[model samples]
Target: MHFISHLSAVLALAPLLSLASSAGLVERADDASCILTASGGDDGPIFVDAVQRCETVVIPAETTLSIATGMNMTGLNDRNIDLRGTVKFTDNMTYWINNGFYFEFQDQIAFWMLGGNNLRLFGGGAIDGSGQVWYDAFATNDTLLRPILFTVYQASNVVIEDIKMLNGPEWINFVNEGQNILYDRINISAVSTSVNPAKNTDGWDIYRSDNVVILNSNINNGDDCVSLKPNSTNIIASYLYCNGSHGISVGSLGQYAGVYDIVENFTSTNVHMYNAENGARIKAFAGPGVGAGIVKNVSFSYFTEGNVDDPLVIDQCYMTNATECAAYPSNVYIQDVVFTNFYGTSSGNEKSVVASLACSPDGRCSDISVSNIYLEPPATYGNATYTCQNVNITGNAAYLFGDCATT
Candidate 1:
């Protein structure tokens, strides 16, 4: 009780401290009251100076802050970003293509990377990524690399809340090598005006991180709503409404030849999925020259779907020809996965088959349980159909899905 009182008193006195005492406030860049614009060259040196001198930096509302170049924002502490305006990047394709950090794993690029401690970014504002041009260009040119909108790289103890992210060029958000990050009440959407749609616009990709939580968000995008990428553990995603997505998925892993991926201890609950291709899916590539790993202790519960195809699916023979897939089954083992409390309506295309679990013929799946599933086939079609192969059923509450077609 005493410590709480003391901390409160200290916080109350924080605003009274003189700006000259600890650090100064630089609110202008060469004349404007509170606006800072970056000219052509690298913008790192200017931001480094501002962050070092100011404890709280405010980007005023009704202004467009242009970033003409890529930046590397690193090694800062105790800062608050009060973003109330639009931050838009230039559409200089050649400059951006030559710049930004490169990740060879997925041929990914990032415009700017943020890292530090006690960092907070919030406001009723938006960050715009000029995506339409990239969308049209990528339709014809597959080799063009579009950069991610925002990346949290090598940072900890961060909170991002109550913001709007719009029209990202590629993946909207990527969190890599960070822990203790929380995102709440954020809005994300991407739509292309042209015929060429936005491609690979994953809402959130958590890779190589732990202890992350994302709650109460809406995602209308082109790809996975939230993907627990390779090496993502201890993650939680709840209360999500996803549309036009590839569903909340795990592992297009085992694609790379020599790498091992591990995804464990994750949960995604209370999701409303609509107009998607799949729901609650786990896909692994099957081939002799593929990676291997273990996925265990994961659960997807309390989900409701509408007009979705493959409402519940697990295909170990992902993206491989049937003959070759049978010849070389997946080496990655899947164990201890639970899918419960799902009720939904399936699309009319696959009228008879609502759920399919086509595991590896080599029996690489074990202890897979399903219960309380009520997925109805198309209204005019016949009864629901279910297929399960090479999996050990731990328990099924009502056998809602009929007899398993075990091989």
Candidate 2:
């Protein structure tokens, strides 16, 4: 799908819709707030009926509430969650690993799963995941499945703003099987005190979601600032400041065989990236029986990075071994990707190449263009190189990493 000539037309076809100013309230039998009594034990029971019974449910700022059990807050409509207190989750690994809601796409699990329509949750309050224990534990036990802090599953018309999330066990937020969601003015941070470090602590992972907007977010984490997982479409991520993380990524898709993944109509703009591994990346699985997928109609523009490695990257052979990748190669296809107005200094960790598009053999990637790129290696690294395999890229070579090495 070549869109070079239709650049203006394609830009005008941005799939994201403007966020609705308001979701008109409906007259319900109970228009009052259900204020829950803070409990030391599981508070899941307190919210069991509040979401269904009242139009507003309040978690007041009086006390520090602890939820020691996994919660399933779903099937709500026209509800507003007014969270004004600090809600902390207990580090009961055994119970949570066994009971958290399972998501098959990424083999992920969630601690507190929330879903509903016309639902809004906004407060200046904080939610703590107590990740130190998980970090230390996962260092020893690789089998440990850390629960995602928050998951919006099977929801629509959701707006979550002005919330503070800290120290999640894994991904901070997961938009799974949801659409028309807006997340704005939110803060997310995951830092571990131990030597293990917080591994895979992504800021947000969107899967099977569409028409979503993530704006004005400040993220300090260890993984992708925002990742579009399989079946994600029509998304916009803007005005983000990310640090100590991987950049905005399209996918590490095609992991499961006999499944087709699609991530399209995505745009990321006005992002400031600092101290990350890569500024922008798209990774897909390789080798036989891995799976098949396509990523198209994507634009990553207006990015500035400092101390980032491989500021632009696309590796279709994500986890597969080198020899196997050469022989079997990835089944996923990538096309119509544009990287524009990017300026950065490479971290110089991998000094061999500052930008890589190592796609699989047999024409799996096409219609890739880059423009207005000004990425230079740090003074310590001397110079940088651009490498490509089995792909043709079009753009201004004088601005990019020189004429790319295509083989």
Candidate 3:
């Protein structure tokens, strides 16, 4: 009974690989334009079929599109798009044919889901990021031109579901300075092997935004599944399966002053991790008065780790340059955090994947609760450890002494 809840997560991470390939050709448009054809009617067979547009399309409610991309619908932020077409990549084999169309899209091709009042991408249509090249570049550390999702900025009321996102570039989806966004039932991946190392393909990067919900998504990448940057609040990531990556995280916050900091009100639950670096982590640098900020009201639960490096972690004084350590307090404030219903096994021979919180004494972690915890890391690995000070954390079997993630 101790390991009951976390044991179920062993089977939770199994993806529907039986499903068909969710990506395909770019569906190239003329002049890289977006084509939009909207038929006005209360409710006639509103259809959005296979069309690669070069310009924007004003798709009203109950309207459907086959499969459209590479275009921006100005003021179409809240439009409902019943993606009724097949959205799959031509093939990942084109990497061999650098002389063909794949080379053009190296710079020309990229699906831009941009500008709308209240936009919807439904009807089971797909959006492939064609991140194969991106993965390769990152693994090899060959290039530094990380791809970006900038044009799709400053839009409100967005919901993308049942859509397949295959092969994301550096940052999968970036929500910039916007609000009310939900990404549900999404399939995002960059599966890795000894030969293929998916690098830096983050699932969701919410930057300077608020009110976001990302749930029921299969995110397997080389970086954090979700990164809450500056001014991000009211964010929730649940029922997530992340594998072969860095893990779910929040931080590198306030890298530079006046970046509109303040990340609060976030919850992450029902998560399954596999072959990752750290299961759950919060890292902040030790720069000149940078890590000092107000980060509060965050909760985590139902976490199951599978063959991971560290099951839990928090590095307050993350140092990029140790020589400049005294520049800032390096003592970040973390409060009102909770972890419950935990269970899972570790990878290799390591049971030492517990909480590693290194917070500053001045303003460390407080008001935290950890209950109903169970960790059975392979039976052969080392034991987990909690490192911190003045933390009020207790409830279930989670051991602590110097744990700063408490009140």
Candidate 4:
């Protein structure tokens, strides 16, 4: 089905879009107040048409719209989606594997993509990914391709708030090539019901986006709470409550060869982390045949952690092995980073080591600062240990690193 082309078309002049009003189907309404319900069939086309033709679309309370196909609802203008009910994707693994929208960066795909200008999607409803089947299938086969729940692609001046996202097969939200976006009061949770856990279900992954703000959210996922991927700048994430996550991170950049990745002017503050792997991290790839990048003017502050494994970290090697990392250092240059006001306890998974700032051997890292770090190891471990390599640190807490190597 084709989307409506002209925004100048009136409600009366719009073509008749078929929406089944059967047992659970939504009744037809005007273009200004279009409401949708499930038709027990593929409601994907109907939902797509409603967003294209209507000025505002509403999914009413107690309603659940079943979507069985991938949707590309991009290039819209001044649209609004009021989701007071639920929009659930059907668990048809075979169909989605063949039809989901592909993204080339990390070889990812999305279930639905919404983008445009002056768009607002706010309602106390949910967008469910029906991910139990995907979770169980991925347990045995690691090569399964799961789709992300929601993606904001090529949009500007958007506000997505007060929404509940559930059971994503992979990532919950992805903001790609967008600008001036704000996500507020968003609650995301992806938990597996069976033996296979919800893996790689990151709360949000921002890539090539600018002026993005994520505030006042609670995320419980398996991967990074919020990750700033390549070319993400001017980003701010604050007042976040992340549990069972991989922390708010920056990069695994410089992975793809010949590509230049950059993350700058990013700040994450007022965060509370619990039972996490790493708290504030910046990771980059290093080795032969990899890309290059720079990370500068970043800050992580006012964080309170509990039982975290590595509360603070900066690893330039990233996924590269230690032997390869020493032989071929990272091409990413890191400078002017600040880590301050951290108060918490480590899980003692590494015994006494609470933080590690391991940069490459070359002059790749400079002007890194640390202060007000009060993270303690378990009682059995005695004292917290901070380790560093090939970087000069300056701050009130610089003594913790204990004679960091100067390249």
Q: How well is each residue in 1-407 modelled by candidate 2, as lDDT tens digits?
A: 21111001101112222222122112222335555545556666556556677677666687566777777888777777767887788888888899888887668888888898878877677889999999999999987899999999899888888899999999999998897888888999899898998989999999988888889999999999999889999998889999999999999899989989999999999999999998989999998889898999999999999989878989999988778888888888999999889887888888746788788878888989988877888777676677777787887743444443334
Ranking by TM-score: 4, 2, 1, 3
lDDT of 3 at 223: 83
lDDT (Cα atoms) of all candidates against the true structure: 0.76, 0.81, 0.57, 0.89
lDDT of 4 by residue, 147-233 (tens): 999999999888888999999999999999998888999999998989888999999999998989898999988899999999998
10 residues in a row with least lDDT, candidate 4: 1-10
TM-score of each: 0.88, 0.89, 0.72, 0.93
Report the C-alpha lDDT of model 3 over 346-371, residue by residue, as the tens digit: 56433454555555444566776777
lDDT per residue as tens, model 1, 218-316: 998888888878888888888999998889888777888888888888888999999988888888888779988778888989999998888888888
Worst window of 10 by summed lDDT in candidate 3: 1-10
Task: Judging by lDDT, tell me the better candidate of 2 and 4.
Answer: 4
The clash count for each model shown is 0, 0, 42, 0
